[model samples]
Target: MDCPAGVVTDNYDIVEDDELWARIGIDWSERSERSERSGDGLDNELWARIGIDWSERSERSERSERSGDGLDKVDKLDKLDSETVASPTQRSTSLPPELLRATPLYEALSGWCRHWQGSDSEVELFHFSRPVNSIDVFLNLGVFGVMWKAQWKAYEGQCGSHDWQTSRWMKLVTLFVVFNSQAAALTSLLLSAALGFAEVYVGAHVLPLNLWVFCGYMVFLVQLCFWQRIRSCFVAPWMVFLDKMCIHQTNMPLKQQGIDGLGTFVKHSEKLLVLWSRRYFTRLSLGGTASLVYSVKLL
Candidate 1:
């Protein structure tokens, strides 16, 4: 007020004003005009040219913040959608279904539902109830020497192994009974079916027919017929990886997994019962002994 102000000082005051001041000039009259225009919520010619207006700072900032937040949320949603659209299997299996619905997996499932609804056993909806223990309270084991059959009785369940999370200290049995021919596997299968049916319907006395059961029509009861050893371990629901029933023959992926996991199976077993005979080793170098070779290598 005491001294005449310079052009820089005049411009600085206008720039720092709480309201938008009109006309960026050093003239006092123009500065007074800017003050008159302050409270109107709009600005001068320069601001108008750019389509900007003097909206309240707080309100404008609030709107900008909301827009930023919305954009961030949109980006996350888009990423989730791309993942599901690309491949549904890539979705994390760990997330609970409630949370999964907003994700792209929900979209993928919706798209999939329109085409074909698989069996209830195979697919599930929002109310995804996990499998009720398919393994019975008691194990109905059918131990066939055949490639894909079993004759199981209702043995006890593994008391502590509810989630298949057994202690490493607990070693189980893996019956390595890979014969050189399919006939051997067939005989073992027949024996399993016969013994299972008999024990349930006829009596335990008829179970002895298994001893005469030859794999490949040979005189070999190679379904690990050492009942005394096996029977001793039956007090607990012993995890017996029986030869025929252990594989998922119809499922190629499962079959390959079983084949690949043989080494691990042998390593963990407390008892690796190899149902070996002269024939197993006699044709050890031959064609059909691939199973025998894998078993031998694993051992």
Candidate 2:
């Protein structure tokens, strides 16, 4: 029988036409027969024909189920082991092997090793040691250096404004007398002890010598104290005051001028105090007290 228009027949004796069989090349009669045999078989056959093997698929599914069963067995074993084992509190307190070898502090410090070993910058080294120890050392040194420089500059300026010869002579005499008396008394004491003479020194002699030495040292110390006070109260304040005055003299707007004046004063004053305390007071009071106690023991 001749086929209808746009109809074609395949060797499978399937009749196809454009409207009904364009997709699979199967005719409508074959499709109906295949659909009658089993509704889902054609889809499975098509999948199989395209290199999709159902046997291999079935094997993979079975293996997956077996793996799931094995995992369930492992979970059951874990639960049993947990119940049979000792309590958590009774577990060993020993550190793990790896952790014992590489401690947390070691790890933290090790992270900075590259920075320390590689860098030539002293500033970076200073910062590197800051987390450990060098911060306090550098801070104390910086404060003292700045303060010393400031004081020396102020002293030089003051000397330039005055009679240089008179001021120089007075300073020279004060230093000489202070050092001479202290040295003389100390030498006398040492000689007396070194001579090994029993009952050699009379109270009359020792008393006046001790008094001279004590008084001389006290005077020198008082001078130093006066110098420190002058620096803090007069020199420092005057510098800050001058800076503020300079700021106010500027031709800025009123609001900006006020802010600048206040800011400059505060900044200088804060710096002065920080330098004074960290530099002078910390060294003189804290360090000296420690040294004094040490010296007394030696004496």
Candidate 3:
């Protein structure tokens, strides 16, 4: 009998039984042979086997290059050395005995006063007065000295940036000088009148003409000295004002800068004035208390 179209016959059984034929369950050996194929069957398997090692090797090489062991050791040493540091030495410079006793503030004031009055004799007299206690002198002198030092340093630093001429410092100095001069004159006249009255009432002997002349000269000198010292006191405020004015002048582009600057100046000035007044009041109170105590003791 003839084989059906889709059925395998005995003659084709041999081809069908072949391994390649068994894969497809067909007998088309001739057609299978004619079909050309290329490429190694093991190529994908081989690539898979080598790819992992290649990636590992690339990673190892990169790590080695980045390690830079020598540089790392040097950096470690620098850090360690920095951490093991030694302490610095202390320095103390002692002032001279005379200077230490006098206090810097007092010296500056005295000097300024002397310069103005063309004589230090009046200051010397006042310096020796009973009411001018040691504590008061020390406090006043020390404070004045410190302030003068600070101001001098500031002046030195700012000299380069500021015009020394036409500075508010000059105006301030002038104002205080004039005010103190008038004050000193009035004080001297009052003192003279009081002394004269006391002498008359107590039947005390009048001072010789020469002594009176000397006292007058000393008073005049002291007045001039006080004027100068007072002028120095005004320097700080003048400097502050000048600084604010300069800032305002320089920052013209900012409309509110000037106003803000002026406000700050006012605030600081108010604070300084308040503090000064407080100190003055405190001193006055202490003086009054001392006077009262002395009067009680006398009575």
Best by TM-score: 3
Alpha carbon lDDT of residue 33, candidate 3?
Answer: 32
lDDT by candidate, in order shown:
0.32, 0.30, 0.31
> TM per model?
0.21, 0.17, 0.25
CA displacement after TM-score superposition, residue 50 of candidate 2 (Å): 54
Candidate 3 ranges beyond 4 A from true positions: 1-163, 166-173, 198-206, 227-263, 267-299
lDDT assessment of candidate 2: 0.30
Q: Which parts of model 1 are misplaced by more than 4 Å? A: 1-234, 282-299
Candidate order (lDDT)? 1, 3, 2
**lDDT (C-alpha) at residue 242 in model 3:** 23
The clash count for each model shown is 15, 1, 6
Query: Using alpha carbons, what is the TM-score of model 2?
Result: 0.17
Candidate 1 lDDT: 0.32
Give the C-alpha lDDT of model 3: 0.31
lDDT digits (tens) for residues 158-177 of candidate 3: 01111222333333344345
**Tens-digit lDDT track of model 1 for 82-145:** 8668331122112222221111111212332231222122332323212111211111111113
Flag clash pairs in model 3. Answer: 104-145, 105-141, 105-144, 105-145, 106-141, 113-225
With candidate 2 superimposed using the best TM-score fit, by how many Å does residue 154's alpha carbon deviate from the native? 21
After aligning candidate 2 to the native by TM-score, how far in Å is the CA of 53 from where it should be?
55
Error of 1 at 90 (Å): 25
Position 220, candidate 1: lDDT: 29
